[model samples]
Target: MPLSDHEQRLLEQMERALYAEDPKFASALEGTGLRTRTRRAVYGSAAGFVVGLGLLMGGLFLHQQWVSVGGFVLMLAGAVFGVTAWRRIPRLALVDPRTGAPVAKRRKRGGSLVDRMEQRWQHRQEQQGRGGGF
Candidate 1:
């Protein structure tokens, strides 16, 4: 279920309290990131997908049975990643020159810096509406 306005407001307040209590912790929480536990599943699977794409293309053009088999194997690998680690990685954009992330941009729409960021994220998420749990 989507959060109610009250829940959203409460979350905002809690975020501010958290930042005030410990800026370091707040900074740590600022960006969505993949946990180390999910890294191999994500990156390894991505590599597999790329491999599969290349192999599938080669198999079609070169009439190579081995390449076709490899492509299917890589597709299976990518599926494993989709089910596990894929959800953990945040959708990220090109890095900002100043802070190496688009989020580092100073301009925002809400009262506090963090609130503005949250608002921006929420807006974009709503606009995209991928229907994912993230």
Candidate 2:
């Protein structure tokens, strides 16, 4: 999954070439991932969670129904924000800064779709061998 330094440099060069050749296209697809923005969103969500926790504790101490309700709302909002940040912030920066292209996420190669299906079928048949019928 890790790219060699030479490959990384090559990819960077290719991307620059592509971008320079057509600024309009490159500009159109520009800025998909802003690190600072992602950081801010994530950090903001964490801060919201801390504040929400405080609100919840205060509401519990006071035993006020309205306070409790408000705290619950705040906690819910914080959780939603935290989830959004955790799920999406990193994904926003899809491109590798060094390569200027989307980084290839590594996944297991089980061969083609049909091959995988056949493998599964073979496995099932083996499991059902002597039994013969479903």
Candidate-wise lDDT, in order: 0.67, 0.69
After superposition, the stretches of candidate 1 with alpha carbons farther than 4 Å from their true spots are: 27-41, 90-134
Runs in model 2 with CA error above 4 Å? 1-33, 90-119, 124-134
Q: lDDT score, residue 33, model 2?
A: 54
lDDT of 1 by residue, 61-123 (tens): 899988988998888879777567767755332232234333332454447888889998898
For candidate 2, the per-residue lDDT at 38 reads 66
Residue 61 miss distance in model 1 (angstroms): 4.3
Q: Score candidate 2 by lDDT.
A: 0.69
Top model number, lDDT: 2
What's the residue-level lDDT of 45 in candidate 2? 75
1-134 in candidate 2: lDDT tens per residue? 98886996787666666665665566455554554576787788778777777877888898876776777787788778878766764432234544466656566597899999999999889879967657
Q: Which is the leading candidate under TM-score?
A: 2
The TM-score measured for candidate 1 stands at: 0.47
